[model samples]
Every structure is written in C-alpha cells, then in structure tokens.
Target chain A: MRRRASLVLLALAVFFAALSPLVRWYAFPRLAKIPPSQYQDMVLEAKNATLLDYTTMKSKKVPEVSIVQTLKGNVAAAGKVRERTGRDVVVWDTLSYVADDKGRMVSRIPERYVFDAHSQEPVHAGGEHVDGDPVRRRGIEYKWPFGTEKRDYEYFDFQTRTSAPIHYKGTRTVHGLETYYFEQTIPWTKVKVPKKLPLGATPETVEQLGLERWYTTKRMFWVEPVTGAPVDGQEIHEEEMRWTDKPGKKPLTAFAGHVRMRPDYQKATVDLVSSQRRLVLTLTTYLPWGSLALGGLLLVGSLTLEARTRTRGRPPGAGGPPVSSAAPGDPARARRPSPAPGGSGGMAPGAVGAFTGAFLKLLPGRRPPDQLTPAARVPSCARWVRPLRDPPAKGAWDSGRATRPAHPGSPPPRTTRDRR
Target chain B: MRALLAAAAGLAAALALVLAVTATGAPPGETSKKPLHTTVPAHP
Candidate 1:
C-alpha cells in the first residue's frame, strides 16, 4: 500500500516540475500581451509656462498649460496586423492636446502607433504613425516591456521621428514602488507645423508666412519592472517658431514648460500599475518557482515513504515473495496487474495489500495487519500495510499445514486434536 | 484511517495543480479615465 502511494506521488512531482518552465516562458508571453482593446489616458500639467498667442503673434506667460494624452487601442487594426505578422499586435490611436488655464486651444497632435503586443517593438504597417509622413518608429515609447532591465533602452520620439538610447540612471522608490529610473535628452531640432492648424491654415501656408517650429525635450520615466508600466513621468519640453525666409523677424515662443503628471493621476497610475505588477510576477516568477519548490518537496516525501515502507513491510526471509504463498489454481494467483500486463501474481512482498488496480502489481487487497495473528503481525509496525489474505471465518474447521493442501487465503489451522 | 490520508493527499495535489494553472490566466480589467480637459475639437 505504501509503495503504491509513493509511486503516485513521484508521478505528480514530475508533472509539476515539468510545468514550471512552461508557465514562465510559454503561458506568460501569450496571456500577458497588451490587450488590443484597452484604452487609457493621463493628464499632465506644466505650471508658469509660455505659449505663443497665434492671434497676437506674441509669446505670453501663462499661469499653466496642460497636456491631455489619450491612448485608445484599435482592435480592428491590431487584428488585421496580427494576421500577417503572426504576432500579437496592438494599434494605439493617440491624441495629445495642449490648452491654457482659460481653456484656449494651443496645439493638437494625433498619432497611430503600431507595435508587438508582447515585446513592444514597433511594427511598420501601412499608413502608420502619421499621414503623408510614415515615420518608421523604433524602440520603447509611452511604455516599456515587462521585466524591464537595469540597462539603457532604445527610446523613440514621436516629434523627432527618431530613436535614441535612454540611459538607466539607477533605481528609485516612487509612490512606495521600487522602480527603474530612465532619462533621455533630445537636442534642438527643427520640425513641421501641425497639419491640422486652427483657421484651416496649411503647413505650407505657415511656412510661407516664415513660421517654423523647433523643439527639444528632456524626458524622464519611473517604470515598475514587473509590469513595465510607468508610475510617474515628466518632460522638460520647449518649442519656438523661427523665421526661415526673414532673419530679422522676432522669434515666437510656441510653447515652453516642465510638464509632469498630475498628482492625482500619478497616484492612480501607481495604484493601477502596482496591482498589475503583482500579477505579472505571479506568472513569470512566483508560480514557476513555487511549483518547482512544491515538486521538490513532494519528491523528497515520496522517496522517504518508499524507504520507510521497504524497511518495515518485509519480515525475516520476506525479501522475495514467500513460496507457496498462493496455490496455482487459485483465482487470486491467476490475476494480472492492470496496465502493466502479463504479471501473474497474488501479492508483492512489501505491498501485501493496496488498491493494486491499474499499473500496480499487488493483489489480494484485503485484511488490516492488526486483525492478523501474532506471526503475521510482526512486519507491519512501521509500514501500515493491510495483509494479503483474510482471517478464516469464525468456527470454520481448517486442515493443518502438514497436508500441503489448505488454502493460504484462510488463516492457519488450529492445533487442538479433534477426535470427532 | 488510510482512506482519510489518501483523501488528504489527493486534495493537496489538486490544490497545487489548480494554483499553477490559474496563475497563467489573463488579467481582464482595463483603465480609461478622461480627465476634465475642456477644449474645442482638435480638427477644423
């Protein structure tokens, strides 16, 4: 009985141990991909900023300028891309809008970013990022990949339409989360005016008016490593319009600010990402290792049980099946083990009684050792093995062992001389 | 007594197996918050 149980435990341990890597490397990538239908938004504020009043064509100092950024996943677009690329994809329709304290419109940039749902690497599909200018995007943007490393990452800029290495500056505890701090500096670069300008003015027309846009920024991100989600972010952003045709024209400050996530938004982001971090760790780290540990413990338990059973289930001269343990014409002796076919046996030496069904080779699964006669009970103290044969029925007359004909399935015969 | 021990051992194995498989499930919830930002339509 004990040996059968140990075998069952050994099989279960191997099963769990084998499942560990499959959980980490296989299931995590497939299940944890960015949801293609997810939609998220954040609010950033820049205090005491400068904005160019287009009506007056002059730079004015404003009390605050706010940027509202929204990312809405395009399920249909991702589905279309996933079919061809054979990879899970996410298409994000992004909108960035700037406004003054009085809620006057400043500038708006709409973008379509496509990327691998698992790795976050940009996928250049048709008509991507922007219209007319199909800027081939590269590197990390908006968010990082899960299990982010403590090394530099190639970061992408939507405005410059280029990729640069963002250096990891060390670790930080932001909002009580241990995070990786990354920063990137972009130098001044001349850029195009918004295609969707107010008053229906075109970029060509704006260029004809000698108004050119120049921009530069220093970006910072604090990302939770497990979820690869940004808990806090900031950008020291500056933009100004200069004259290309006329050198003496006074340059207009288009926008300038040290923009940061709103305090409430930061708190919400931390709360949201913190929960996600735990889940990601569960699949990629915790579950795999936990299963492996449990498997190891089970393995030890099984081996110990087998050792103890072997030491205690065998009596003197019981290393092998006892001769004449079962008669040849006995129905129990003719029984074969399930699954492991062609085994003709009534009982195993150590496994005197057990389920002994499929794939287990013991038989005559009956009778507890405590009910056995003293000679039969000698070997069952350490191992809780039921005996192979049952006690004879009460008052039933049994022939003595000298006849060599009494069935062993019955208890040993009484020695009292019956002169009947 | 032996039957009870077998039952307890089976239960523990099932519980461990369930935990390992359930950990691979997808995270279903999403976040979408539109803050109080007033502005004219972005396009003309």
Candidate 2:
C-alpha cells in the first residue's frame, strides 16, 4: 500500500510537470482576453446563459424595457430612463416586450432609440448616438437634439482580438425561469476612445477625461439562467471622479435595464431611469452584433490555430512527406514528375493550390497575413509587430492597432434612429 | 525495488493522462478567456 501511494505521488508530479506548460501557454492567454468583471456579469444575463448568485446589497431602481420589432425589418428599440439614490428600492412597472411578425423572431438589426422621460418622445433628434465619430466632450456639437444622440461605435467598436471572461456566479429561479448566473468584467484600460480630441486637451488629458466620464459604468448582466442568452440585466454608472463638498453624493449615474420577448428578436424594450421618473421606450431596434462577432471569431481562431500548428514543436507525423523541388527547366513546372496515386505523398489540385497560396503569403514582399499572429509570436510585442527573430518585412503585418479598421457590417453613424 | 519503480511509472502515466484532460478541458462556468475575434454584442 505504501508503495502504491508513493507511485501515485510521483505520477502526480510528472503529470503536472508536463501539463503545467500547456496550461500556462493556452489557458493563460485566455485570462487576458476576458472582459472586465462587471461587464461579464451583465453579458451572461443578456445571453440568458446563466446568472451568478450576487448579494443584492441594494436593489436600487429597476428600469423597465419594452421589446418590439419595427417595419423596416430592423430590430428597433426605445426605452425609458431612470436613476435613484441610496438603498431606496423603487417599484417600477413598465410593460416592454418584443414585437414580432405575428409569431416569428428576427434578431439582427443595428439601430435603436432611447426615448424621452415617459412619453414616446425621443430625447435627441436621433434616438441613438450619431454614427460616424465619437463626440469629444465640449467638442463640435451636432445640431440640437441630435447632439443628445451619442454615437458610440466611434469609441466603442468591438475589439476583434480580445474576449471578455464569462463567470458562472450561481443559479436562481426568476419568475419560474431557472437561470444561470454568469458575469464578466471589461476593464477601463481596454476601452477605445476617439482618435481626435476636444480643443485644449492633451492626449493624457483626453484619456484621463474619458476615463473619468465613462469609467464608473459597472454593468451587471443576468443571462437566461438556463439558456445563457440575454433575458434581463442592469447597468450601474458611478462617477469615477467625485465632486468635493458633497461627500458621498456623486453625480447621478444612469441606470438602464433590458429584456427580450417572443415574436421578434430584433425589437426590444429598454428602461432608462433617473432620480425623478422612470421612462420606457418600446419598439427599439437592436443591432445584432453577436452573429457577426461569432463569424469574425471563427475566422480569427482558425488563423491563430494554423499559426500555432506551424510554431508548435513538430509532432511525430509532421514533416513526414518528402520535400519537393521545382524544375530548373521551367519556372512554373515541377522538376520531378507528379507523384502517382499510390505514391507516398500527393495532394489534389485544389489542396495544392490552397497550400501554395498560404506558403506564398509567408514569403516576404507579399501582403501581410490577413489575420495577425497572437501576441506571443510577435517579437517584443512591438506597437505593430513585436520584436521577433524573423520579422516578416513584406507580407501583411499585424500592426496590433488598438482599434481595427471599420468593416461593412458596422452600422452607419447616422441612421433612421435620428428621424425617430 | 524494480517492481516499485515499474508501479510508480505506471501510476505516473495514468496521472499524466488525467492532468492532460483536465488542463485541456473548457474552463468552469464560462470560459475565462475567449478566443480572440469572438464578438460579444452589447445587451439592450
């Protein structure tokens, strides 16, 4: 028995020794990609994925969201606004549900509206933020009412190379729905700001001011407890910078709540709450970025995996095929005759063409790799390409730019939301 | 002594397999790090 136990211990050590590096390499990178803690929570809730059992020290105010589908085949949205103070719990009753085409659901439309106080009136000329550039505080203001509609994509476009962490907090039964409590957090450092800044602002001042204005948005999302999809969730915006003289009294933070109903997935109702009153907007359009994002992720992942395969230590079967040489007689012809069907190695025309394309891409003076290599491969993690032994001078280089260039699917800065 | 050594090696092999599986397994709850490029939409 003693011998057996000793063997077990030795095995455990060896097991960990071999496995630790793998974990550190693959698993560790994931930690960096996770979203901030607060955002993770809210994301899980919205995905209806799961819910975490969190201590509701204070319920605060619950903003009511009404989901609805609009005529343009887009998921249009409008919601009320609300904010509250202290531990005071406010009872809010707002009927918000998604509008469906009789009984069907559509989930991918990119514009939404935020309504005024309680009435259907939109606060800004455009219900949503203006589309093109992010607004700099005290910067050039768009026309009246339109100014109220803030364009976020300019400053908040999704990072194609980063991922937020999802945590399963716990489980709960809400209105007969068994939901899993999953949460995530998005750090302020990862936030993308506008390229240009307001007048009189230094780069440092711009970042500092941006952080101050947006940092306190602690978002707690609740997924469908069961399905891990969005059901309902809330956001608590606290001011990063505090005003003196009024200790404990920070500026009013916006509280927004959302929920998706049956029929159409595009339409949603949102609740925006303030200290004074609660407003609910219905038939708001929801821009479905989830599918678009997933597609981008798959493409990026396949590329990373291919890079890893190339860089990883060769497995036994790798490099087994005989190397081929080109013929000196003709530039385009192979020196040796093509391998026969029963030959040791032969690739079909299609497969050969694909391999040739990839191999040619790695050559210098060609376009850089469409997908950038992971941080590890980049030498020294250079601003664009890291310091590495062999930096590809030619090919498409991964600049590792903080924000990626815009894509077609991204919504326009100004959309019908403005007319609303 | 040789039997003991052989037993130890066998045990080590088994434990290594277990550890490999655990390490490769998906993270508990939600994934801590999602693969880069996976997009998460903002909730309404």
**List of chain B TM-scores, one per candidate:** 0.48, 0.55
TM agreement with the true structure for every prediction: 0.72, 0.20
RMSD of each: 9.4, 31.4
Report the C-alpha lDDT of model 1 over A1-420, residue by residue, as the tens digit: 766777667666666776677678767787777888778778888999998877777899999988888788877788788788877788888878787888766767888889988889888876476534678887978999988999999998878888999999999999899999999999999987877655566788878887888999999999998888999999999998899887797778888999999888888889999889888999888989998898788766665555455434333433232222333234453352221111112222223133222222222332233344544433322111122243334443345222112443433432323211
Instruction: For each candidate, report its DockQ versus the true two-chain complex.
Output: 0.12, 0.04
True contacts kept of each: 0.07, 0.07
Candidate 2, TM-score of its B chain:
0.55
DockQ for candidate 2, C-alpha atoms: 0.04
User: Would you list the clashing residue pairs of candidate 1?
Assistant: none
In model 1, chain B matches the true chain B with a TM-score of 0.48
The weakest ten consecutive residues by lDDT in model 1 chain A span: A338-347
Please give, for residues A1-420, the per-residue lDDT of candidate 2 as tens digits. 332343344334333343334344433232211111111111111222111111221123422322232211111121112222211111111111221212222111222323321122233323343223222122111011111121211112121113333455666554444444444444543233323222333335534533322232333443441112334444432223222345565532222233323222212311211110111011011112332344344333333333333333222222221222322223333324442221112222243224433643564433232343332122111211111223444432443322323333322222222312
